[model samples]
Target chain A: MTSMDFLLLTKGPLFQIAIAIFALGMLVRLVEIFALGRPHNYAAARGGQLIPGLKTVYKRFNPDPGTFKRAPFDVIVGIIWHIGFVVALLLFIPHIELIKSMFGVTWPGLPNPVVDAVTAITLFALLATLIHRLTHPVKKFLSTPEDYLIWTVTFLPVLTGYLAYHRLINPYPLALGLHILAAEIFLIVLPFTKLTHIFTAFVARWYNGAIFGRKGVQS
Target chain B: MTEFSLERGLNALREEMDAPVASFFSSCVHCGLCATACPFYVETGDPKYTPIHKLEPMRLLWEQEYTLWGKLKSKLGLGKQVTDEMLEEWEPLLYDSCSMCGRCSMVCPVGNDIHYMIRKAREGMVASGHAPEGLIAASVRAVNTGSPMGLQWKTLDVQIKHVETATDLEVPIDKQGADYLVLLSSMEIINFPEYLEAITKIFDHAGVSWTLSQQCFEATNAGIQIGSKDIAATLVQRVVDAAESLGVKNVISPECGHAYTAIRWEGPNAIKRAYPFKVFHIIEVLDQLRAAGRIKTEGKEMDRLSMHDPCNLARKSGVIQQQRSLMDLVADNFVDLEEHGKFQWCCGAGGGVSSNERAEELKMAAFKRKKAQIEQVEPERMVTMCATCRTQLEEGLEEFNMDIPVVGLTEMIADHLVERDKPDDAAAKAGG
Candidate 1:
């Protein structure tokens, strides 16, 4: 197919299919998780859990001081990439326009230059994470093939978006088409991989906090 | 009865699967931050000791049984099965290296509750006949003899007599209608008879009516450490039966960390019923007495004192502030370790690690983390609330040739109790 045709294919039917798979896959996964059903705790609680549970959902955004000291590189890089990724995803005009078109809602986007800078920093941070995983003993040992696969799927969209915005590829349509295609792949694979953490992390945090909080712990 | 096998282990793991476990497994990003929080990994610098990695078999089972993609993979023979061999290899990882300290659960960036998963994983290990021999023995002893250490009630009765003679106070036995029914760990009865004396003096001074149940004095639950809920429930039911028969208002878990968690937190759940009597750690009771102006003390300890918060007590049970409050009552020169309260390093022998003889070297290796924390503070004496933690601290410090003596917080509080006439008068005065 020509670059224009490829661009149209990615932005049209392919995008629709990707969104369907992403949404349905995520729903099924979430159902599988919640449907397992935690056992009812018969023990009396030491304190209220609701507020603490909600608090942890937000509190885990920052690592505790001791944890940060122990794994400073991971914590810092993790925070940078996450913030950068979110900023690039939501604050960039093109992404926001796409989101607005899909969901019928729009927010003011950041200036293109700022988004571009963030995208670059995010790309570097993602690369740093991969290198760290390959080197850090615990992370290297814990990582599986799926980890690298997920990392690639996660990294590609940002890398492709940055390249497309810069028109680094000879044909602009081809670059743009690749960027959209990369994002579609990300969406399709997300619910099947560790990338599902995007949704489940909050649930995990709430459960952890609630469990500990019931015992009057602040965790 | 069916013997333990890989199928049984797999079935146990399937039973252990719950929403929290599912959510935790789904959320793990493999960032390995849990290793930083784990004493085993932190001290040994071994990736194998990574807390999440220790739960790999369980995680695999979870994936294969729970998720659609994983189910598909398993049907196609592409998914990994938890084998008897895997359980054998992981025995050291699950039992030896892990204290179930929950520090890893505390620090997981994604909030995986890695230690919680490890606890559930042990159920499978036990069913597979892969549990450490020491733990298996302890569980057997706990079930048969009523104490993991195989101590009988007569052993505790002897300690009770010694405490009565030393303190010149009546050690009430199975006193019906007492305010609290006290439970003791075998470690306390065997190693620290003074714990009985301290509680005797404190109870007398506070005018709190308490008794020791001859029916079930032991509090430590090996079933919990060995990861067997049926055994845990049996142990818990003994305490429940004893407390109900005595009609005590509350049950006090002695200076034992896991014992406190087992009876106070996990007890009701294990038996699948709400407890008629409430449970409190000794420190929590002491703090309550202190708050109620029931515990009056005259002298403060002059030595430089610091505390090691037991993981089950501080991190798991949220009895953090109670110990600190009790410390402030009698400690004139208290200095907290750099990491104290919920963040305190474990003494490296909790959750049956101390019971497992094969884990001796790994247990001491894990002690290095606590040793480093203790070195930074250089306290003249270390105090803690849990019997297991206290024993580990004393042993660990001595092994490292650190002269910091370990003391139980309850005993320290007892040593400072003010001499007063008619303990009942003191209570009446406080009441008025």
Candidate 2:
């Protein structure tokens, strides 16, 4: 296929299909969870639930001291990567234009240099995570093949996006096409893999806090 | 009798896949933070005891039953099947090593309640007949004799006579329309009769009207420890029936952590109704009494003292501050363990681990965490509320050859009540 045709394919039908699957899969999974429906807690609340529930969603951004002390490397890298990924992916000028065309949403993009710095730092964080997983016995023990696969998918979109932005791999269209394809794959697998934690983490934290909060214990 | 089979275990697990369970399984990021949070993993450095890994069988069952891709993978024979052998292998991981302390739950970055999942996984273990024999026997005895230790009210009656003789106080029994219905665990009845005397003196001094039911006095729920709701409900029903019959306004759970949890938190849910009377852990009630100027103490415990917070009471039920409040009342030199209160480490004998003889070594190993925390404080005495925790603390300290005396907080408070001319006058003064 010509470079133009390959670029068109990655940017056209593949992108649409990936977004469709991502949206549909997330909706169905969330619906399935809600459909199961938690039983109403019959006990009287010792402390109001709503405030603590909200607090937990906010509080987990800064972990408790004990947890931080135990898993400093993981916690630090995890927070950095999450912030970097969001800033790099959503605030880059090209990605904003893509979102504007698809969803009719508009937002100012970060400057190109700022985006480049975040993208580089986030890639390093991803590599550090992979190294930690391989070398840390507990991480290695808990990881399944699916864990590594999800990591690879999540890592590639940023790596290839950065490559395409710089045009470091010869033939700019081919490099850009590879970036789009990697992103499409990442989106397609998001709901099915542990990447779903990106969405479920808030709800899980809220529930954990609510349960403990009702007992008058802060999470 | 139905035979234990893989199908039965799988069905039990599938039935437990509620909203929280589904979200928890989906949201776990495999960060291994839970391992660091777990005393078993942290103490032993064994990856197998990682809190999430202990629930692998349940996770497999969730995958097979709930997920579309999991179904496809199973169809293609790429998925792991939860076999009977797997359940057998995981029994020790689920019951023996785990104390259900919930430190892992608190530390989970994605907010998965690993402790709750472990509780759910126990249902399958029990259904599959892979539960420890000690737990099964305890459950059976709890149902048959109304106490897991198989002690009848007759045993408590004998202890009551001793308490009466020692305190020169009447231990009220089955008194209708009393303000509170007090329950005792078998551990208290056998091992610590001073708890009965302590309450009698304190309640008399406080002018509190309380009664012990001849019909239902045991507070400990073996069914909970064994992870059987039906059996737990049956045990809980006895207390509900006694409380409703007595028309008490409250039920005071004794100084046992799981007993407090079973009655105050899990009991109403198990029976599917809000209780007619509220429940309070002994420490909570004591704190309330102290807040209201009901309890008056005359002396302080003259030593450098620290506390051991039971997991179920402090972490699970929010009884952390209440105990500390009461501690502040009677102890002049009160210092806390570095990790006391809601963040306190488990005594390593909760959630039926103490009952399972096979878990003794692991339980002691887990105690090293608490031991180290205590050593950091280096207190002359250690005070705690839960009887199970007290027993574990005593045994653990004895094992380590530590001379620190572990005293029940209730008994400690009782030891310092202001003297009065008569019990009647004391009651009248408290009432006035």
Name the candidate that leads on lDDT. Answer: 1
Identify the candidate with maximal DockQ: 1
The parts of candidate 1 lying over 4 Å away from their true place are B422-432
Q: How does candidate 1 fare on TM-score?
A: 0.98
Chain A TM-score for each of the predictions? 0.98, 0.97
For model 1, how big is the iRMS in angstroms?
0.7
Q: Estimate, for each residue in B311-395, the C-alpha lDDT of model 1 and write its tens digit.
A: 9989999888888888999999999999888888888899899999999999999999999888888889988878788888888
Model 2 TM-score, all chains together:
0.97
- Give me the candidate number with maximum TM-score: 1
What's the TM-score of each model vs. the native?
0.98, 0.97
Write model 2 residue lDDT over B206-313, tens digit each, in one string: 999999999899899987887777788999999999999999999999999999888888888889999999999888888999999999998788899999999999
**CAPRI class assigned to model 2:** medium
- lDDT per residue for candidate 1 within A121-187, as digits (tens), equals 9999999999999998888998899999999998999999999999899599999999999999999
**For candidate 1, the TM-score of chain A alone relative to the native chain A:** 0.98
